[model samples]
Target chain A: MIIQVQDLVKRYGDFVAVDHLSFDVAPGEIFGLLGPNGAGKTTTIRVIMDILAPDEGEVTVLGQPPGRAKGQVGYLPEERGLYRNLKVLDTLVYLAELKGTPRGEARERGTALLERIRLEEWADRKVKDLSQGMQQRLQLVAAVIHDPEVLFLDEPFQGLDPVNVERVKSLIAEWHQAGKTIVLSSHRMNLVEVLCDRVLLINRGRSVLYGPLAQIKQAHAPHSIRVHAADLPLDLPGVIQVQPDDGAFNLTLVEGVDPKGVLRELLDRDVDLRAFEVAPVPLEDIFLAVVQDEDESEEGVNGLA
Target chain B: MDWRKVWVVARHEYLHSVRRPGFIIMTAIVPLFGILVLFVGTFFAGQASRLGDFFVEQFDSTSQRIGVVDRSGYFTPILPEYRERFLLYEGESEAETALLAEEVTTVLVIGEDYLETGRVVAVTKGSGFGSAAVSDSGSVRGFFVDHLLAGQVDPALQRRAANPMSVEPRVVSSRGESQGEGAWGFVFTFVVPYVLSIFLVMTIFISSGYLLQSVAEEKESRVVEIVVSSVRPIELMSGKVIGLGAVGLTQVMVWMLSAVGFSSGAVALLAVVGAASIPARVLILGVVYYLLGYTLYAILMAGVGALGATSQESQQLAGIFSMFAAVPYMISGFLFANPNALLARILSFFPLTAPTMMMLRLPLAEVPWIDVAGSIILLLLSIPVALWAGGKLFRVGLLIYGKRPTLKEIWLILREG
Candidate 1:
């Protein structure tokens, strides 16, 4: 594991920010932490970055605690903080040096990153003078200029225009391709769905779902099949119900019935089926369902535990 | 704690300050203003002294012209004995005409029964110069008349009134140098202390204000978080204090040099006027007091600055500290009268007031060696405590968002840290 957090807890006076949360991110994976605002996502990231210490449990990054591994990691906090008075290149190089990069190399790497982000024109401009999207891009460069082994980004894509969003997404992908461990946190599920391979969904400081994104979606699969046919039957065997809309039918299968078997039966009935798909539930739907479930479960526990 | 990191922070701070138009203007303009004010003050002072010297010289050169209309014949012989010091006119009309035309300065009229009444009245025509000049002329005439009266007293009465015993003053110093007696010590004790205190307090006020405003600006802009992540809070605070303190010191050094240059010119002017020179020890004590005074106020100002959330807030907070600094000023009248009194001694050892009080007393030669040593020790000890508290407050205050912290909140923050 590149980062391991065990039962991490953080309290501000009597308010608990992170409550007994545990998770791990494997090397070379983009792990998404999906949550709403004030859902402890930022607190967890801060704990992992060593910016804040947890009141309970342990956080180990790359086989050591966060501080020991700080230089080997890069963190882009949820708060969009940058030295507005500093020139873009200088700010980037400063952050790189802080991560233990030598000055010469940090400058060289910072320049390269600026070029990659198409922000070389703004190299001499103060960060304050740049547009919000441009500043966000510069922040990304600051995070990655040191070539950190692990990158922790909180809401990295927040406030980005679509073009810049795509640019940032590709950058993350490129970093992951270079075998860097990434922990991505965002409230937007679509971005997380496209970028993340594994996810940890936390609701009110506790993990509601933790696994590979594909597995989580499959586990929460709805009992529905997509059918495309020139003429569709009103009803079929092992099909409990059907809804025809938008040139296709959403067929609900019976309990314990195989969707593949239903598709085969539909094909044998001489139906001109243009397509057959087992309408896998979207990760967003699963996330909402799981979070809702956790809320209900908490209400029960709040009455007792 | 890393020197390299501290240097990095310092370099960044220096660059940031040097690049700002405000800093550049202050760096250049402050010294210029100081020089300008000093020149203006010196010009006015020189003009006033020249006028005074001219009046004294005029009085010494010319004797009073008196027209005595004494019908009693008692003053007939009295005028000739001191005739060289008096110009006698025959009639009041003649004297009045001479006085208006700026010839005779006085006219004395004695009644026919003046010997029995012993009554006299003096009058002079106005030169239209104003009442003050006329009053001054009257005073000068009074001096001459009093001397004349004393000279005319009975010989036996004068003999009896003369001092019965006299002792010749002697000095037995090995150096045989004459000890100067004048208000110079008072100048050293009162004026020097007051001026030095103002400079010290102003330096702290200006520099700490700059530091606090810089911090608050960055915090409000959310830039402090970025800087803090790279450099420790101690490094940031120390760098700012040192950088702006350097600026303050530069202003002070320039002002001091200008003052020294002006004083040297004044000394040359004084030589021409035959006035005593300003002592070298006075200048040395001024410099010593300035340094000591600055150190005491600068550290405390830095602490007060850290608790402020904005430039305006820092300024308001600095006002309170400045009031504390002004305590010595408020009580300086008492200090002057009793330089070595109990209150002065206690204030001299108190770190906050010591720099100003000691500087004030040093010129008087009233500050004991032990008190000076003790004050220095106390001042040095307080510096670290101030820095530590300032650093802690700065660390917490920089990260705080939204509402400004109260003193209680600040205490809580320090405790948390």
Candidate 2:
């Protein structure tokens, strides 16, 4: 593990921003921190960035304390900023120098980064003159100009149009492939599912789910099969209830039933089954289910009161 | 403690300020105005003194004629010079005719009881709409005393009888030199102190304002979030303070160097830099006080800037501190009257007021070395505490936005920080 956060807790006055939260990132893995708007994802990121101190517990990043090894960590804050009056290249070079890059090399690297982003023509232009997407691109370049070993991106693709979003996605993917340990926080679950090897989902400062992406998906998989038939017969062996999935019916089985045996029995009974499939549940469905469960539980308690 | 980061931040700030069009224009204009005021003011002052000397020389050599209508027989024998200028008239009409024909400059009419009353009136020009009282006829009185009294009284007593006694003026310097009194003392005593104090105040005010705006801009933009991730808060604040201080110092130096150039040029062409001359001690002290004063205000402004979410908020917050900064200048004039006044002495040692107060009093009075040393020590000692407080505010407030922090909340932040 390149980073370990053990029993980490952070608070904002009376509000618990990150409550006894503990998670780790394996070396060279793309880790996703998933949460809703006011969830503790951002608070956790800030603590890991060393921008905020945790109220309790410890975080060891890159084999040292967060700030002790900050030179090796690149962080893109949720709220973006750049020297608006400065040239794009100068802004990048200056930021790189702050991370301990030499001035001459920083400029050269900044130029190359701008070129890679197709912002070379706009390098000499002031940041305020650039489009918002272009400015964000420049900001990202500034973040990784020194080629840090670890990266933290907080909603890095926010405010970006689809095209710019793809551009930034490719850049992040490229960075991930280059053996840089990366932690990404965003509201876009689909993107996280595609990009992250592991994910930790937290809500109201408490962890709702955390594990390898494949394992989490497996754990959330419903024991059901989709049946497309002309007449779906009820009272089938091992069938408990049926939910709709497009034109097909999702047949839920009793806890320990064998779906293959049921399909074999159905085939023998001369049922007109056109198609039968078992698919892994979508991550989005899992996210909505867990969130809805949490809200309903709270509502139930409120109803009791 | 990271000097390289501080240096980088400072260099960035310096370049940022120096490249502005307003800074360049202001740099060019300060000394031009300073020099023009100095030379032109001295020239007019010099002209007034020369004009006074010219009037005295003309008064001594100019010729004048007088016609006297002495009804009472007081003067039997008249001197030759008096016969030419002070001739007796037969009647009032003749005297009036002689005066109107440009024959005499004045006509003196003796009163009916002139011998007993010693009363006389002289007429010449009209009584214009000015402060020319009829009783103010010094020339007529002088003629009576110098001419008429010379014959009436004994010669030895006559000279002494006209002017009984006069004061003999004397001025002694601290070096025991018998220096005569003149307005020259004002040039060093008042002008130097006034200019140096004002210069320190204006430079710090403008420079610290720039520092405040810069920090607030970074905060509002949320750029500091990324910056603080890499560098410590004090390092960033110190870099900005040191950087902007350099920019202000550069501007003031340009003004001073240009003033020196203008003074040298004036000495060559008009010979009038004397009235505007400032002592070497004042220059050195001005620079020292300016540095001290800027540090105090810069960190304070930096704290305000960090707390502010917008440029206007930062300026308004700094405005509160700036109100106190003006108190010293407003009360410094009193120190001119009594340099040892309790209020003046108290303000001299107070950090907020020390720089300007000392500059105001140092040139005017023989300020004790202990007082000067005390004020400097107090100012220097207050700086670290201010930085510590400002740094605390800066670190805690850098990330906060939209909402303004109350004093209690800020104090809480200080405690927590």
Candidate 3:
């Protein structure tokens, strides 16, 4: 495991911020830490990053303590900021140096990263002079200035416009291709779904779901198929209902019915079908469903108590 | 502690603070302003001296005369040199007549019992208050003293009797060497330390403020988390303390040098730094206390900074902690009056007030070596404790946002740490 967290618990006074949380990330894989606001995701990351100590249990990065492994770990904290008084390039170089990068190499890489972000012209300008999106890009550059082996980016796309978000997404993709382990934490399910290989969904400081992204989507996938067809029959065998969905028809199949059989029925009816596919649940929908389930279960436990 | 990282952070903080417009302006403007005041002062002083010399030339003693009526038989024959200014007469009526005619500025009557009672009366035209009265009285007294010892003593002996004594003090060392600095030496002994104490306190105030401001700025900007991820809280705090202390020392050195430079060029005030020598021990001790004192306050202000969520809040919190440093200054009068007083000694031993207290007391009197050693030892001991406590506060407080911690929470944080 590149990163390991076992039975981790952290608290602030009487409030438990993380409770018995456990997960691990493999090298060269994108791991998603998905949760709502105040769900202990930040606290968990802080403990993993060794910014905050865990009240109970253990965390090890690269078979060592977090502090020892910090040099190899790059972190972009959820609360994004840089030295506003420092120049853009200088801030990146300083952060890189803090991670034990040599000044000459840090400066060289920092300049290259600035150029990569198309921020070369703004390198000499103070960070405060940059627009919010530009500063966000610069912060991203700072996070990876040392080109660490493992990167933890918390809400990396926050405060970024779509173009910049795409820019950041491509950078993350490039890092993953270079075989760097990454723990991408965000509540934006679509981005996480597109980028993460495995996920750990948390709510109220407890894991609500954990597994491979494809397996989770498969398990949560609805019993339906999306078909783009005109003149589709509502009263077809093994078809319980039909509903219009995004310029297509959603066929809710009966229990134990194969989706392929529904497509066969549509073809026999001579329906002009433009497209057909099994409707996998959107990660956003799965996220909401799991969160709602957790809340209701919690209420049930509270009611019983 | 990661010495290299500490060094890096210190270098960064030092450069950052010195580069700030606020620090630059404070360091530059104060000395420039001091020079301006000195030049302007020298100009006015020159003009006043010239005016004074003109007045002296116009009103020299040749323009005034005094009428004396001698009943004591002491003025049987007026001395030839006194014949110009002193006009002798037989009775008080003749002297009064000369005075009414303005032949003399005053009339003096030496009584018949002058040999027994030593009484003399002077009459002058009444003007509410004037320098004329002072000059007339001086002339009459000189006439009486000069004649009182005419044949009984030598002229030099009479002159010595009239002038009395001029005191020149020499401080003797244990090795039997004596150094006399006269009045300027005394002024320097008292004034130098007083000024040094003020400077030490100001440096502490300014440097500790920078530490607090630096911490508060990092926290307020939400940049502390990223920085702390790569280094410990203690390292960050130590770096800021060292860096800002250097900046404060730089500022004070500039001011001191500018003071010497400006004072040297002036006419009337030039003796201040030139004639008064600061003891080597005081200079060394001043630096020692400044470093220790700055560290103590820097840790304190850093803790205060950690507790505050905003720079304004940190400043408010600092206002309370600053009262501790201000205690020495507030009671400076008592300290000056009695340098080795019990209160002064007690304050000197306290880490918060020690630097300023010692600065105030060191020059006023010979502070015992034991007390100096004891206070320094106490200050040395206090820093680690402060760092521990400050680190606890800093570790937890730097992460909290949008609200100040309550006393109970602070206690809990310390306890937990």
Q: Each candidate's lDDT (Cα)? A: 0.69, 0.79, 0.81
lDDT, candidate 1, at A44: 87
For candidate 1, write residues A1-305 as lDDT tens digits.
89899999998778888899999899999999998788899888867776566799999989998766657888776766687788998888767766567889988988898889888998999988999888888888787888989888888888889999888888999999999989999888777777889999887788888999988876778878888887887668899888887998888887768788987887788889899998767677887888787778889999897
TM-score of 2: 0.80
Residue B92 lDDT in candidate 3: 84
Tens digit per residue, CA lDDT, model 1, B1-417: 655666666566666666778656655654565456556656676463454345455644235555556566655655444465455566777767776787656666767776578666667565433323433553334434544456678855543444233232222223444322233222323344355445645665566566666776776666666555555667667666676666666656665565455444544543223223334444565556555556545555555655666666766876776675566667767766776778878887787777666766655444666787788788778777777776677766665666678878778766886
Return the lDDT, model 1, position A246: 98
DockQ of each: 0.34, 0.64, 0.62
TM per candidate:
0.75, 0.80, 0.82
lDDT of 3 by residue, A1-305 (tens): 99999999988878998999999999999999988788899899888788898999899999998788778889999986788889998898888888889999999999999999899999899999999888888888787888888999998877778898889999999999989999999988787689999999988788888989999987787888888876587788998899997788888877778788887877888899999999667787998987888779989999999
> Best candidate per TM-score, number?
3
Task: Report the candidate with higher TM-score, 1 versus 2.
Answer: 2
Tell me which residue pairs clash in candidate 3. Answer: none
Docking class of 3: medium
- Candidate number that wins on DockQ, 2 or 3: 2
Ten-residue stretch with the least lDDT total in model 2 chain A: A276-285
Worst 10 residues of 2 chain B by lDDT: B128-137
TM-score for chain B of each model, two decimals: 0.64, 0.69, 0.70
lDDT of 3 by residue, B28-137 (tens): 87577767766665566545324334544564454568787888889767877689888899888888888889888777677899999987776777772323553444
